[model samples]
Target: MPPLAIMPVLRFDPAAVAECISPLPPLEHTTLYENHNCSTSSTKVLYQIATHHYDNGVFEMKWGRVIIICAIVLSIQIASADTLNLTAGTYETFADNRTVQITANLTDSTGYPVNGTRVNFTTDLGNLSASYNYTNASGIATVNISSWDIGNATITAEAPTATNATVNMTFVVGPVSKIVLTSILEGTVNTTHLITATVYDKTAWEFANDENKWRIMPDVKLNFTITPPPGSTYNSANITPPSNTTNKSGITTAIVRLDKCAGTNGINVNVTNEDGVDVHESKTIIGVAGAPVNLSITANPYNVSANGIDTSQITGKVTDVFLNPIISTGSVRFNTSGNIITKPLDGTGEAAISIGPSIFTVNVTVNGTYLDEVGNSTNLTNETVVVFYTEEPARIVVTADATRISTTDIPGVNESAITAAVIDRWGHVLSNRSVNFSTTLGDLSSTTAITDANGQATTTLHSDITGDATVTASTLNDSGYEINGTIVIRIMNESFVSVITNIEPDPVEPGGIINVTTVISGQGNITGTRLAAHAMLALDRSGSMDPDYYAGTPLDVVLVLDRSGSMKFLGSGPEQPMTDAKTAAKVFMDNLVSNAQVGVVSFSSSSRIDTGLTLLHSSDNKTLVRGAIDGIYASGSTAIGDGLADANSMLVNGRGDARKITVLLTDGVCNAGSDRDCSNAIAIANANHITIYTIGLGSAEYIDEPLLQRIASETGGTYYNAPSSSELRAVYN
Candidate 1:
């Protein structure tokens, strides 16, 4: 068999041939020619058979014919192998049952388009418009696909004529169903936090082993909205894309800013798709306090007495550089040069402490910390310090330069000099303190004198009456205690002349000078001079006079009281200046002489006649005056001049037969009304022949000493400076 050339015969199944050729055009009969050669040893002859088909039967086959037919069939199978290429118009769509177009291009292996080819289409998810499609004259086939369920879908196209001509595309189909947020759960105030929101679609489906299911959607346009918690805010610039829009992946990111006092803050994120499907997610963030940067300390009363028993309050406040108060439940420690006591801070970041009554200035220092709930402590960077001073006063002494004197029956003769020295308990002389001088049976040159640098105060006393006169010197110590000293002096009337009178011609004409002569007999000595007197008393009831500064006295007098607002400060315990003045006036009325008349006038910014001048001899009149005084209350401003004018009016209109006098007492300056000038008041007293006695109570700073002195001097009266209530009682006596 190897020696001889063997010919291979091509065989074909009739059913297969029929099926493959059914769509082809029918072949016509063709005759084959033979070629012959006659020469030499052999003659060769070749004959080509004609291919044909009869209506009824048998067919003839030739080797050359079989070869030609086989070649044609093989070429057609190769061209159909790569004729179709599939592509999707869009890879993503919503699961709302919307349709998408899928296309397949028909082409041969040489890249030449093959028309009239049948293409088959299908999807792993959803449905297609048709399972098969024929390529058009342009060699392209298209189908519409849709999905009712959410998921990813795979679309495939294949040419039925060619086994290797196939193409597939994946598409996403769904609506937004869920959202997720990712961020830090806690952060400091005024800080930034990275937040991310991921959008998902519950209707989206994924395919595995020909099965379809829901999955995350891709290539979807998502919109995001962020809602910050209370006391928190967001940064517009920190949002990606600036419009809070998600890309095809359905994700958005932003940075949020929290407030300074943020407590437990939560952030909410909402996401929606183009189809109007939405979802939400939330996250909680814890806010922390800032660091402390400064501390301030203060003392309410920076100074106290060195009696070693007083205390002061020390407070400290903690804050940041911005001066915002630090809210914490922490304690602060206090240090001092003397003694230290501690207290915790309140909600306002303030702490109070008690200090000691020491001799030296106390330097206080404060240092502390603020703690947060997370056990973080912030120390104060600045140190706070405060100082307190302690002061005290000790004792006083008095002396007299001359103790005795003698004078004739005159007004201003017998004079004695008195001196007072203020000495501290340590034997050191203290100056600038006031010493008041009073006499029981005489008049003093000056009622008040301040101690000089030498710690000495001097005054002169004079009396025309021959008797024993008592002089008192008093001052108030630093502790509000009274220090007093007194001395008695004998006044003897040593006049050398007795009563002897002569009249020129026993009588004289009007406006003519008459010669009068008096002779001294040296027989009788005059001891005292007596005169009837009428007096008015003016009193101040300013707020500072709220203390019980006076008691009642027995005298035929008009009580004028100041009822200014400052009188509220006048009194001790339950007795105010007005109340005390009323008590004193009532007592004076009780002790008045039977034939004496009493009245009452109370002045503030104005004056009123509470009780008119009435003889105390009548019990009914006394009751009426006392009741009026008791009804007086304190209000308004101090009107010294107005008060004096009113008192002068009462006395000038009263019983004319009585010698007139006025007493004025005030604890404050005249501060109300045009009459505060006081000159008019003095002139009125002088015109009425009323002797004015002025009493200044309290410190020199409060009383107008020069004005009081002028009023008393012009009226030929005395001025008394009562530095304290006890001294005032002595003045009344």
Candidate 2:
């Protein structure tokens, strides 16, 4: 670019220049434009002014946001009339050419309609064309939509210059219908399916005539596409449509896919029209989550049944590799070739369906799953299964050591070879079943010799002084059960005595009370069935003060002695000094159960309430109590509470019995509750339900002489005592 030259001149028209600073007589509003601040522009005011020419004269106006209105005309400003409003008729909209219209809404400052003004219109999305004609005196306009863009668009119109006023509008472009959804069905696997779609004009044209409109396409075809869930890959090639219908919807089905093996398919299709429209829609098909069948059992448990004189039992668990039940929702049945008690079917979890004696055959039939819930499995295997049962070694378990002692001193019997064997109801020895024998000596070292399948054995007795021996049988199974019972016989050398019978319900139900008693006895060891159990002993201290207290306990004894007024007559020595009687009484306490659990009670018109139950303990308490007993000189008459009401209550609450027992030595009859005839008291004692052995010691006192026998018989306890001094020296043992 070279040098350029420019020239400037000023020929001011006062009329024109003054008009810029002045205004027409004020109408509604006037817009002011001037060149007075030219110093900021570094130029003359006239040089800074902008000029616009109307049809005749030129005027000075400013470019700004203010709208200008002229109340009167200045010079020959050209004015022509144009329709301010226009309405056009509707037409059918095509995907391509959607029709449109335009008009100007114009007026003078006085609100009178004016025409001959130019108007411009446009849209936010594509191009728009409109006729820029002056409005023909109306104040309205109409416009039509014609476009393929499937989204929203805003249309606008405005007048010329900074005074331009524009109106915007939005219209719906569709009921986009060409995209259609259809269905197809297939069984499974590479199953090919054919689908058809007929693409039509999306716009419904209300205005049409017997003229050439959108007719059948020369060639209609559409491309098919599909998208799958993330991480769920699918093949696009399988969705390819036939070549015949190009750019149109025809055999346009998507193929259903299947994996040769397993899993789920969540797939859908995407269809695109010639007009660039896309549609989407999905389905889930399953192929491999089916049930499995065919369970086979290799072993048949024939040995579990009863055979001959030596019957037996079989135990073991059966399982599959997956640990799932082979018999599905239904059950399995078993049948044996021989034996009668044996059933044709047995439920799961049981080792056998027994056959008489021993012989058995393990046959199994596996039922199928509930078909109603799950359809039959094509992979189902064999229907029959085989189970195997085997018998373990049979043994007649004996629970006693080899030792013989005289039965003379034992309270329950006159024989010493006390032992028990655990066998079936039929007398056959059970394998791995246990037979244990224990005695009160607490040495309790003995067992019923383990027998062979023959089911017979001998158990030698271990040297436990004298008491009851027991046998318990139990299996070596989880939550294995047990059965127990007792037999009493004397052990070691001692003078024989009358029998004291004590029986107990061996193993009792949970929370059940056990009734035990010493039925009859002279001077002998306190032997009874429960002695074999690690027992807690209770002795009555009712005035039947005898020199022989608990001469019968073998293991440990918890003595609960009664101290009612009747004991006053049985006191040792003449005049029955409380101190001397209690002193002589200490001698009998020597024959205690092993770790003697000694508890004492004394009753009068008012009996001693609480007496701690524990061990003889050889502590300060034992000596003090012994002193107290020695100091206890009788004064009142016997109030034989009768039966063992209080004693029974104590045992029930104590519950401290491996084998619980009470030695109720009452010499006097029950006078307090005797009117009820010891019947209710006896019932209460019976309800004590626990075994009680009585020691009846008595003089000719009315309480002792009258009811003594009844108290002894009622509690299953021994009644013993010397109402005189001379008799007290004789040891009960």
Candidate 3:
């Protein structure tokens, strides 16, 4: 500011304060002015001038020192002036805990930072917070709090910055809690549905002001609005999920529960989605009713052979069923015979089922089951089996069809009649049913047929029979057929050979011949001319009758009393012998003739020749008739033919069609007559087809089978040893 004045000082160093003072104008060049002024005028003038120069220089130096000191002071003041500032934010605390941190940073007002400045603490997080924090070298201040809650608290720092002097922030502490809602799926009436808008409030967004328009959005929520068929309602108390969970999946389940309310038929519901719209659909469940029934049966399979071709027999009775039978009137039809068969056989005399297909059905009645041969009656009202038949094999007398010993016919004889007589291995008849010959290549029928006694026909081939024919006999339907069966033979072929004559018994004719010459002659001879009869009359007569038993043993026999037995004694001619035993003898002969050939052996103790086996003959049926009448008187000791050999012999060899037989009639025993040779005679008679018919006169005890049989059986006849006169008549008949 004053260089001129300071120039004097400018030449100086501050270290020369002492030196400048030391050159003090000469302190007092002192009083020199005064002294000089007094001494001389010129001296006075020069003294004044020197004094002025000194005064000026001294003033200038002094002023320069003052300027330099002032400059130095101002530089010192600028070097040390700045302030601290602080900022605050974000503090956390427990729910209702109200504890958090408040911070304020320090810096100067012009934006220059200041460190180590003191700061005031804040509020806002819950209830508790620190009041102050020093601004570290970074100019930041922080505080830890104990509790904070209540909400809407403020944190301010007083003098946190050198210029602003204070800092503040507002905080709203909200409830820090998690809320959850759980729900089940719901179904809709149709396939799809829309959602209505949904709203939620979450603690995360508690800071969002409601006045700002939207509620705080939650972390998760089972919030959905599914639109069902219009006007859909829910069965569940709450259309929305109850509070427990917050997952979206839960929302689906909730919809299902609601839809179910529409009825188990299926249900639908509506809900509001954040953006409402009908979109997805829910599904319904399924259920069951009850168990099913199992029906079964055991039957002959479709393809096998059984009994007849009939269904009834083929599929036999269900003899046993675990269930109840079908009942009618009073009985149950529960059984079958299990056989099907053809009927009415031909010349074989014995009918068999196998001819056709034979099937039998067992009859089932209310009582129980039995064979048709057993309790077999029609079961329309009583459950009996009818053993019905179907169309039968047309009875055709197949006679040598083209004659190659038709295997299709009778195997051996080229002719076979369609007959039910054929039976199966099972003994079942080839049912009276139809014969179905159904092979690809076979003659099923004869264009021409002849009817017969048996509703059968004689089949005449159109041209000739050939190739193969498969036949099934069945009574069932066109469906059924008889499978297995067989055939048999004729019965008239069983007969015996020789015939016999003559006996030694007293009543018998002596010769071993019966005179049928006339009758035989009338019938004509086996030759154009034969003289054998003439020669017979003159033949050797040495052949006397052999003893019926031993030489003249009386024949043991019974005689007719005057009762019915006596009727035999009244006859004449061939029956004339009845006069002795009376008509009873003749009647006896008639009866004997029917069953056995009889040689008349009349005896009365000592027997005599009456009509011998020679006169009695089955061929000379007249002789046989005559011999029956020859009778003996019942008197004296009963004699028995030890053997009726000779008389028995007469009956044999005398038969044409009649059985050779010897009949001995006596009222007495063999006591008077030797019974010795009787047995022998019996032997002889037996070999000759001669038998004795004996009748006891009265008592049942009078006749012994051994004795009678000896004469009768040994001779191939049976004895009718009657007991009383009444029985005697019966025996004759």
On lDDT, the leading prediction is 1
lDDT of 3 by residue, 563-646 (tens): 122324322333323343445555655343222323344443434333333221122232223422322333333345632433
TM-score of each: 0.30, 0.29, 0.23
What would the per-residue lDDT of candidate 1 be over residues 1-733, giving only the tens digit for each residue?
Answer: 1221322222244443443334434334343322212122332223243323322122333223312222122221212145567777777776656778888897766777767667888788888899989888878888998776657777777774455344344444456666667888776666777777665655432333332344555454434344344534332112334236555666677776655554566666665656664566677776554556677766656654433345555566766544545666554544432222233456676655444433333354544344333435556533445454423335445554445566545433356677777765434455788888888987888999998866778898777777888888888887788888788877766543233344453223322344555433331244443322332222221112212224233233666766776666744643355455556556756665555677677777876655566665433345445545655667788788888887899898877666665666677788887788689989998998878888876678887888888888998888888665435545654
RMSD of each: 26.6, 26.7, 40.5
Model 3 C-alpha lDDT versus the unseen true structure:
0.33
- Once fitted onto the true fold, the runs of candidate 3 whose alpha carbons sit more than 4 angstroms away are 1-103, 109-111, 124-138, 142-150, 158-733
TM-score of 2: 0.29
Task: State the lDDT of candidate 2 residue by residue for 1-733, as single tens digits.
Answer: 2221322112234454344324433322333433333212322222222223232133433222222232222342322222233322322333444565544566644456644445655567544655243434653333444564444445555544214443343343333334333544322333444444433344323223422332222244445543322333333224544222524322244444443233344445444544466643344444331232333322334233333322222222222332322222322222222101111112342222221232222233322211212323232222334332334323224332213344433444433343344455433344334455544443333554453343333334444345444433323322454455554433545643443334344322222344555433333444433332333233222112221354344222223334555454444445443333344456555445324544444544433322334444332234333433332323343444532455555556653433445554444545454433545656665775555554445446533443555655666655565555455436234
Model 3 weakest 10-residue run by lDDT: 69-78
After superposing candidate 2 on the true structure, give the runs of residues whose Cα lies further than 4 Å from its correct spot. 1-142, 145-178, 181-183, 189-246, 259-265, 271-278, 283-435, 439-484, 489-733
Ranking of candidates on TM-score, top first: 1, 2, 3
**Where is model 1 poorest over a 10-residue stretch in terms of lDDT?**
71-80
